[model samples]
Target: MDSSTHKLYHEHDFDSRQFLENYFSDKPDMVFGDDSLTFLIENFRHVFTVGHINGDILIDLSIGSFVHHLYSACEFFKNIIVLKVNNRCIMELKRWVDDRTGAFYWGHTSTILQEKEENSDQFEDQNAKLRSAIQHIVKYDLEKENMTDPLVLPLADCVLSAWLLDVISKDQDDYIRYFRKFSRLLKPGGHVILIGVLNITYFTVGKDKFQGFPYDEDFVRKALAGEGFIIDYCKVQERTAVSDLIDYKAVIFIAAHKEK
Candidate 1:
């Protein structure tokens, strides 16, 4: 968790605006579709996004979809708070926000220290290396008083975590603990939206290797049910991109609401 790790994690100058511009220019017709964005706008007021690191390109897609959905659903803008373990991801997200008109808050652990450090070299990509380095450095950055802390944040209308739980731990108990911690942040009747790879054995982002839990639809459903969240919907969708390096067949999108 030294300064070197911090430097590595925050070393990306990803042009999100340019990326989005290219994306929209290519697919202008479907860029702001009516289904997903409409759903997001009609349901959530405030959003808290987690697990968006620079190396993880899926964050761009996930957040982009969420934002587009919100914009199409609501006339005015809403507040957005992004929580990431990697400084580079936060920086890129901040840069993306700078060109747009919306309120955003960002926070992360200042160092690369984690509770467990056994599988440090799991992924072997530069982005994964930096992300893993940041995770190693900021393992304990989430404090009880911080809004980024999964257990203590104010009830949010919607909480989004993309590809987070699998990277946190391989043990199901540990995964459940993490999910429970995140569940505490939602207000009664609020919703949780998550996307993850199912049954993914392993993958590389930058220079770090990632081992995913053997997650299936049943496991996720049971986990959410255990947390008192009623599963409103779940789907398996494909993620297609030019930077399609990961071998995940489908991305699981889940929408669950807390009972009053």
Candidate 2:
């Protein structure tokens, strides 16, 4: 394993969290009163805030204070499960879920940053290079033998993976495959709520860097289609800057169900 890369990622995540906290503190309504959070609260009965939660599972592949917003919004559902592959992310999530009944899992990946930096060097070829890098990262990280397969979790009425897709894998195909695995983790007819970043670049947590996979409305729609999920309700909300330290455009929140 590339230890330096790993450390860099961890530091980036730390910095990102602080940045987001400050960013969100400036605009509470943009996050809490936003339609995306409203859609999630209204749709998913049982939410999993993948990385961390104040009360529910806030499983988003990226790092942001959004997890805090989830906690505040879903305080009624005190039972939350937060999972993260990154030790740093997991720790942050754990702290947020402190004393709450929640489960944590380790599943970290660094493909996004590698791809971003490599492509950043060549401005003209950045998009194509980033896309290619993403594909490679997804295939190797999520599809490799070392990664978890057939993620079996206790039956839940619904699952929520916020900001997860944009950072978990780079390749669209691999992203779809990972989503398929996520779908299988839920019981038949179960639903999933996904929140993603649109055209975001690198973010930081402390000194570590967490990479985001660029995505658009069409990409997200098509990805869900491939995973046997139909969009029940979808909306494109303005990107509430979670961090002034980094550059990101907007966030796309989606509510979909696994066809019975």
Best by lDDT: 2
State the local distance difference test value for candidate 2.
0.47
Off by over 4 Å in 1: 1-77, 100-153, 238-244
159-179 in candidate 1: lDDT tens per residue? 666556755545688778877
Per-candidate TM equals 0.54, 0.58
Q: Considering every candidate listed, which one attains the maximal TM-score?
A: 2
For model 2, the superposed segments whose C-alpha errors exceed 4 Å read: 1-66, 69-79, 99-152, 240-244
- Model 2 alpha-carbon miss at residue 12, Å: 8.4
Q: Rate the local accuracy (lDDT) of all candidates.
A: 0.44, 0.47
What is candidate 1's local distance difference test score? 0.44
- Across 90-136, the per-residue lDDT of candidate 2 in tens digits comes to 54444434423432211111122223233434334322332222211
lDDT of 2 at 74: 39
